[model samples]
Target: MFFLSLVVLDPLVVVLVGLVRREGIGLAGAVMALDLCGNWWGNWHWLRDDPSQLLRLLPLTLFGVFVVASTLPLHRVVARTTARSETALPSA
Candidate 1:
């Protein structure tokens, strides 16, 4: 629950951690997609039983919001921080 909200507040953490620990931001998003699907499966009782539109859309909406937030701002940061030397493949 808290983790879901934090993504809204700041998705940069997810992007950075994904880039640093995994291969890139895409993997991080894939992980989040898995989590989203898991949430739908795990919480189907409440989600299906809920009457409010907000409640129904909450979890599903979060993934798209987080993905956009994580990618848009970080695109600038990555462009600024990375150089050709850093992104280039090393000659072996």
Candidate 2:
């Protein structure tokens, strides 16, 4: 239950934060997709106990690593883009 919550909640939180911050929809969608894929991969093992536990774990672990590696750069890009658009708007 805890893991399931993490899987669902984390992406939702990220998406909401992105939207509230006025980040691009395309980028937010991509991030959500990646997050869901990673969450699925991370939780795949719990679906069944197979002979390929390691195989299932491999992708999950890799996904985690990828998330850790990419999150900062992704956040930076979103922030910069949002800032640019906001600054481009004419002052009221």
Candidate 3:
């Protein structure tokens, strides 16, 4: 059920990214983090049997690494943007 939901949720996040909303970016980071953990958990047996299998999944692993590396910087940018926009609005 969880994996099945990701099928729809993943694409929805892509669309959310298109909107460039802070929530979307946050969600994307979260989804990708979950995805990486799920993939590793599912593949652990094969990876244990043949450590070389890591080579086959290196791209995915690298992408996961990149997402992990970039998420913090991206989050800060979104936060700053949100803060700026909020401050720009006139007081009620």
Candidate 4:
């Protein structure tokens, strides 16, 4: 049940807000870490039993890593763009 909340929170709270704000990227990265931990914890038993099942979950793991790895670069780009836009705005 708690894992389900993490799943919902990741997209709705992180992804949607991140689309509108650069800080969202950092939030998304944090949420992704939590999600990865939750998934690993939830699947530990099955993974321990079969081992090969890790293959099936590999893509999810990779994606989480990608999100975490890219967050800083992506956030910097967004922040730079926003700063440029704000500065470019003429005084009203």
For each candidate, what TM-score against the reference?
0.45, 0.53, 0.81, 0.84
lDDT of candidate 4 over 29-89, digit per residue (tens): 8888988888899899999999999997899999999999998998888889989999999
Q: What is the lDDT for 43 in model 4?
A: 91
| lDDT scores of the candidates, listed in order | 0.60, 0.62, 0.84, 0.84
Model 3: per-residue lDDT, tens digit, 36-59?
A: 888888889999999998886788
Cα lDDT of model 1 overall? 0.60
Encode model 2's per-residue lDDT on 3-88: one tens digit a residue. 56566666766776657543433444455456656566666677466646666556655766665566567677778987988899
Write candidate 1's Cα lDDT for 1-92 as tens digits: 74566565346645666565323454456556666666667777775677464576586668666974586465656665666546685877
Candidate no. 1 TM-score: 0.45
Q: Which residue pairs in candidate 4 collide?
A: none
TM-score pick, better of 2 and 3: 3
The residue pairs in collision within model 1 are: none
1 or 4: which has the higher lDDT? 4
Span of 10 residues, lowest total lDDT, candidate 4 = 11-20
Residue 81 in model 1: shift from native, Å? 7.0
